[model samples]
Target chain A: MTHILDIKDLVTNFYTYEGVVKALNKVSFHVNHGSTFGLVGESGCGKSVTVRSIMQIVQSPGVIEGGEIHFSPDSDNGETGIDLLKQTERFMQDLRGNKISMIFQEPNAALNPIMTIGEQIAESYVFHRKNQIIEKILGLDRTGENLFPKVSANPLFLPLYHLALHRPDAFLLELIKKVPFLRNWDRAVLHTAIEKSVELLATLGIPNPDKIVHQYPHNLSGGMKQRVVIAIALASEPVLLIADEATSNLDVTVQAQILDLLKDLKKKNIISSILLITHDLGVVNETCDRVGVMYAGNLCEVGKVTDLFENPKHPYTKALLDSVPKIRQIGDLKSIAGNVPNLVNPPLGCRFHPRCGHAMAKCKEVFPEMTIVDDDHEVACYLYH
Target chain B: MVVVLFGVSVLMFSILMSFSPERRAVAYATSAKQIKEIPILVAKYGLDDPYHIQYIRWITQIFKGNFGYSTVASSPTLDAIIKYLPTTIELNLFSMPIIITLGIWLGTIAGIHRDTFIDHTTRIAAIVGWSLPTFLFALILLMIFYSQFQLFPPEVISDHIDDFISDNPDKFIQYTGMYVIDGLLNRNFEVVADALKHLVLPVVTQVTVVIAILVRVMRSSMLEEISKDYVITAKAKGVDINTIHQKHVKKNALLPAITISGWLVCLSIEGSVTVEFIFNRAGLGLLLVKAATQLDIPVVLAISLLLGLIYVVANLIIDVLYAVIDPRIRLN
Candidate 1:
């Protein structure tokens, strides 16, 4: 029931040639532990901007005006929560691929061209599980004793153990000297990492993972590339995975497959939560436990999927839901009028006032605050207030 | 096919023009008897026969490595070519690394920091260098460094191998024709050091124009690569900016520059003429100019053929290199 990640009154702005563009103003949402939370909005609705802010991926000219992104690490002992927004970039980097990984929209561009898919995935495991891999290689576990009885019995390695403990620097120097010809040893390490990556890829329903891992990103199909990207994100067993329009570039069938893969992973990997950012309301309906609707640069509504779909409280959310074609419905599919207001010089009060059907005189003069309607639903509109 | 056709035509034209009797005497002739003497003069050059026969005889002699005698040098045309080829190669070998390294490095930096003061300054320098003729730049460099500062030697310092061997025969064979290479091969640190110091100004003069062209090309290519979606993806993946530059940006950007560099190498054989002249170095550029001015048809044709051959070979090498640098370029 506890929230794994929380964003409070987040505001992100960009300094442009025209003026300060408020990309995200007072936007707030949360992902409960082990729950898939969907952030659905049109382009420029601050969905991507919000997730990037959590990952501290925003570049200069785009500034975090105010916010806090608190992440509660999923640990057996229940460690203290960390505020990601306040952390230095170095600290964020330590947490990024390890604690929170992201799968971007374009698979070809998302993966590095110069590196093979296997090497890049292996790097994640190498960086985050350095100590674990080292221990596995050295045949020692955390207790400072040999895990393998055969390894412990080797008389040749006895001096190595003593050297490692008594003269660690000398041991390292000796190791470095043998490294130029350490192909077998290096292969052993890399092979283990690749095996782990392949296993992760297979779990994502990628056929012939063994063949796929050896290939470069360009060699794979679009869907395969996406699946490989997903495999990489899942490599470190992160607490949260951000799929930034991960399925947008894929075909409809592939999109369904990718969605199913994510759902399966979520069920199997009980500790991980997904923050799915997309513009598709139908996708959110199928996969998300809860949905947050955004308009312009503000969160217009946040509610349980069924409630938001059946009874969207905010005028903007209602209009968005109406826009989706329904097979059972008789009347024409309603579309929201007007484009999203310019962020540089947004409408004075409610950004959607220009198009909202229920816009009152006050709606154009005063901004609305999010008002709780039920334990699970919240709407940001004058009607709710 | 075009190159081959052009080359054949040039060969024929050079031979015909070289063997033609002097026009001045023909222009002054008043009688048939005076003109009768022209056939003897033409016969002396073996030009009184049919064009095809004359071409066949010339080509046959060329195939035998007898490129005919140079009217200007009074030596076998091939001998003149062989004597000058090494000097040109040596000059290029000395100058190329400087140009490429400086060009690529400065260009990459300028492109990465576009719109900044450094970018503007590099742009200005490139424009000035590229706009000016190579001979003009060479002369300016010669005047400033050689005539004014007395920094360079003004000509190559020829050390006889016989003298070097007799005085220090042990080290004589080690100092290759290229003093720099010889210094390194012999492990004569002082000789290597001294050769580099002597090499400074001429190398600088040669590199100036090359760097100007290369920097502009490399900068634009790098800037284009930087804007690619892959770069954004790299940033999103949290790859460090410098690593992205080294592994992705530089590698990708170098492709176009590498192709251009191959052509530049062939071009340098001809391009460095002015540079060689400024330094009074005996390279093919100076040879080419002198041959052209003196209408030394045999030498001119030989040099042109050598340059054309170099251009074709360099292009072939570049095509092969493309497959190595970019996996997308599949060799047919």
Candidate 2:
């Protein structure tokens, strides 16, 4: 099986005035191609930090101390995988929106409020798909030359279009662009990009694409704005879509709709894999194929969603599953005993030993390595070992 | 806006009314004979009436463009403003652009490279510029550039250039009532260069002091804006760092800076009072100080009203710009 994204010993730290926060500690995981991999954890368990590291967008004061994020731009061909951490920033720019795109948690804060929805969505195409768009324009011009011989031969658009595609900043091109008759090529390119943006929005199930395209983010509802953000992410035809708590901020109905939309997009092969980060276990059960349980910057368990939920091995995962309130339960839900340790000075050995119910003296002295109890199921605990 | 203007006019009138009717009458007197007939003039202008009636009469005259006589300029107050306004406006036109652009540019550099040597240097510069008294700074610059080097002289155009323009009006039309502009219009490079030479010391003083306020405001604003979630979103979209800086961070950061800009412009006008006085330029600020010292009530009142109007108008422009820069402001 080919993994679209693989991680090995990923470590990230935040340098603050107080101390260096060990946000992520030697974490490792692999997201299978065409599968929805859910990272479930409590707040501040480094769930967001994990994917932010993968995308190389961790905020300032935080640094990726050590990590190997092996990403295959071509999903079916594993041999072409590159260590994303070693890639140049310029190379990362191309891979970011083109091969891997992200939908953020807060739609209200995600989109640039000043820019119109259409321009924002069309930006991906203009930046990443420039060659393809230029080629398409040239192909159309060729057809026009054959059919409308007199018009095509007389107009300066063909040359100007070539200049705009090839040497956009050429002095003669800029000077010619000021002339009224020769400006059509540039306008046509932008117009066609906007038309593609409208189609992309329509594909995301946004109504009144023609109207919404011209409106700012402030003019759209929370749901509509999230859809626009999704439209932008999907515009470049990314193979891996990382939804960072994408539906957590929306209303329940909107959340359901968004989840359904992601599922439908997956079914249609618009996205080959999804790294869905959420605190809600229900969302993972409904949407994810595989689940990874995180505790104090550590991945405590990894297995299929059903198997992890039914047979949680690590104490942290078991406690997390037990805490979910059931309809018929009369007593209080089981709560984890200790708070998440401050990662700056996290507990030694196993991070969960301080909070575990059956922690032996060995649990405090030595950390257990990952032990496989079932096929495709792994847990990091002495009990499991 | 209208209500605010009206309130400003009323407030100015009431302040003018605080002077006894006899003292207020002196504003209408032009010569020794008029001074003798001050009582009659006072009654004619309703100076002895209730304050509201007095305010009405004053506004009625202001509405007709009769701002009374200015003892400082020895001319009609309106005529004095017309003559002096252009020089102040010319000084601002040169300084405003440099102050705004440099302030924002330096602030962005400092904010982006926060805690680095560049940030520390700008911070110290801002502190020094902001803390030093403007008049003292202006005097120091005048001493270094004018008294010592004799490179830049005080006052509006030099005596020779002024003589050339007045001596040859046909060649140099005083368009816009500004020497630099009129020189440019007439293609007189000598006069334009001379006017700019005279402007250097004052412009430098104003730019330094004003940039301090803006740099601090913009630096904090930029820091706040770059930390916002939208900036992260932009980065996640694969935008180059410079593109994110220019297109995303700068535009959003300008909100607080825009709010400060209009006030800075207005404050610079007040700042020019000292700049003009120390530089010996015959602009409105110089006229204002001379008028106040000599109890030239009409000129003082006129200038006070003009300053109030300027502040109001600057605030209106700032509000409009706020709406233009941030769509959220428009929605609200």
Candidate 3:
């Protein structure tokens, strides 16, 4: 299978007054095309940092020290992927929320409070789909007065609109933007962008989308707000959707609903793949086709979800799977022995060595490298070697 | 709002009443010829009555627009306010916009480039402006501009332009009691230029002192908003950094700065007193100082009431602005 995203040896750090935090220490992973990849880890184990590093949005004081994020938006076309880390910020912007988008953990904080739902959704469309919206606007029959006839009727924009309809790439349109008085032409474009936003909201199954578009984020419920945030990410039709704990903050039913919505969207080919980051093992088992177990900035194991759950390899992954209680005849819930280490000064080798029941002398002195153990399965442990 | 204004007026009136009735009666002496009839004036006005009666009488007279007489201006207290208020208003009209816009602009730049040289420099400048005494700053500006360079002089207008306006009533009309506006009304460019030239030193002093607090408030507010999750969402949405700065960060930052802005305007009004005094401009601030020093109770009481009213109105406007900026505020 072709990889949609290939991240190798990604290193991210946070500089502070105390010390430089090794947030992501040579972390390596990838998401395959048309498949759901779940990255599961405990809190503060670099799960969020890993995805944030891929998106190149690690917050201030956190920096991406080095690595390569090779993203091929058109994965099946046999095209060479571009190293996202090397791309200019302008290029990254074009890729983000267009080719790749992220849904944050907190729906309440994800959407802007002051902006209307319609305007929030419309922003992404305006930023990345201006040309498409303009083309859609031109397709309308202009024989009579349309929704935005005021600009068209103005003498200043009469000729401009004619060119925008016949030849959108006309130099006159570009030059007209330089003229302060004539720049009202773009208002028609914005008006059409709003129209497209309404359609996007309707697609998300938001009731009475026309009315909801005018309402603010605070006017919506938790589930509805999450849907709005999803609608925004889908506005540009991203090829890869990163759901960063998108359903963790929700209740059981809402979480189920959101997960179903994501699955439905994946089935509909709205998003080609998803990078689901969560700490819930149940969520991972229910949705992910593939899983990567992360522990303290290290990927301990990678395998098919069924294989990883049934035939877990790394000791950490085995312990993680053992911790989940079955439905009927369950023993006491088993937790891993030790806590996640501080990344600033993690253990010398094998970050989990202190917690591992099978820790050997070598495990304490040397970091284990990832080794392929089976078809499409890899593990980083001395036992695997 | 009415209740708040009333409360402020009561507080001010009670403070004024603390002075003995003999002192309050000095307002009724009216002219130099009547100076010897202080006791008689006190008796006629009932200045020595019970505190409640005095309070009731003062409230009623205020409602009736009789603010007593100002010995300092040699006119009615209300008349003195009417004549002097325009000067301060004109000064504020020029300085307030500059202070607000520049403060927000500089604050945003400082916040966006935080920990950089620009941020350090702006913060250092803010500290100096905030700590420097207003009168000392005004005096220094005066020494540099008026005393040494002779570039811009203080006072409301050049003596010749003042003489021209007073002598030729047919040519110049004081429509707004502001020379700038009146100059435009009469097409007298010389009057407008002279008025603005005299305003430079005072307006500069006022803006420098007031902008310091505003910049600090806006800077910290912006830093807090810039780190919010919504901003990260905007960045994730591929929104341009500049758009994120203006729409997401700056708009949210302005929420806290709104309260500070109101306070800054109030401070500017108070700072105008020092500015006006040093520059020899006949504004409300200068009038206030004269009134306070002479124990001119009527003038002082009227000025305090006006200041209270200004605060109430400014706070009301800030609340409205707060609702406009944050939709959640509208829900309440």
Please tell me which predicted candidate would have the highest DockQ against the true structure: 3
lDDT of 2 by residue, A89-207 (tens): 89988888778899999999998878788778877777776645665666754433321111122244667667667786789876875678664455555566677888788788888
Leading candidate by TM-score: 3
Question: Which TM-score values does chain B get in all models?
Answer: 0.83, 0.93, 0.95
The order by descending DockQ is: 3, 2, 1
State fnat for each of the candidate structures: 0.16, 0.66, 0.72
Score candidate 3 by lDDT. 0.86
Write the residue-wise lDDT of candidate 1 on B9-92 in tens digits.
566465546544555234334588978787666566665667677667766776788886675566777877776666677778
Residue-level lDDT of model 3, residues B1-332, one tens digit each, is 77876787778778888888777777556688787788888888787888888778887899999998788999998999999999999999999999999999999899999999999999999989888998999999989988999989988998998888899888888889899988888888989999999889888888888898888888999899888888878888899899898888898898888898897787788778888998999999999999888888878888888888888889989998999889997954
Task: Tell me the tens digit of each residue's lDDT in model 2 across B99-191.
Answer: 999999999988888899999999999999888888999999888888899999999999998888889889888889888998889999998
Name the DockQ score for candidate 2: 0.72
| Global fold similarity of model 1 (TM-score) | 0.84
> TM-score rank, highest first?
3, 2, 1
Clash pairs for candidate 3:
none
- Candidate 2, after superposition: displacement of residue B194 in Å? 0.8
TM-score of each: 0.84, 0.93, 0.94
- Segments of candidate 3 deviating more than 4 angstroms: A140-155, A158-185, B26-39
